[model samples]
Target: MTGKMLRGMVITLVLAGGLAACANDPSITDTIDTRSAPDGMKTVGVCYNGNNTTRAAVSEIALKACPKGTTKLKLWDKDHMANACPLTKVNRVVFLCLH
Candidate 1:
């Protein structure tokens, strides 16, 4: 391959990597509801630092720990938990973000 073509590919790869890194970085803001599904369903909200991959892993753990037929689990918020998912024994709960 030509030098110019190789350089272009390298630059593209670098830029793509940087963009992905930026995308993975989570932003924190207080919200009323953190559940991916905002419904009457019992929802557990944890403090998500925008790490979707880790969050999914954590969620896998939660699902095993939680009771059957429970779906709503998310990054935690104290008030939301008290009000929303209190009756949700099946609601998988976790706080303190993990990398």
Candidate 2:
């Protein structure tokens, strides 16, 4: 191939690679919020990365939020929006742990 054609191809390849990297970037943010608990219920918030967050992983975090002897009443995400437990691979997982 001519030098000009080769240069153009290289630039195209580089741009494509950059776009792909951005598309697959894992911009996950996990957090825990305990400010919304009811009068008697203790609540905690947890966030996990979407690429590796699993139900088991979330449960483990929730189990740690509450005291050992306390009863776990519910485990949900942000205002009980998600009904599923051990949530899917999401960009942000905001779990509310209640005891």
**Candidate models: Cα lDDT each:** 0.44, 0.50
In angstroms, how far off is 1's CA in candidate 1? 2.2
lDDT of 1: 0.44
lDDT string for model 1 (1-99, tens) is: 999999999999999999766544322223344444334433333332332436565466445444566555545434423433322221323432331
**Model 2: residues with Cα > 4 Å off, grouped in runs:** 1-35, 79-99
| Candidate 1: residue 91 lDDT (0-100) | 30
Tell me the deviation in Å of residue 74 in model 2. 1.2
Per-residue lDDT, model 2, residue 16, is: 93
Summarize candidate 2's per-residue lDDT along 1-99 as a digit string, tens digits. 999999999999999988765544332233333235445554545544446546676666666765566555364444333422233323333444443
Clash pairs, model 1 backbone:
45-75, 45-76, 46-74, 46-75, 46-76, 47-76
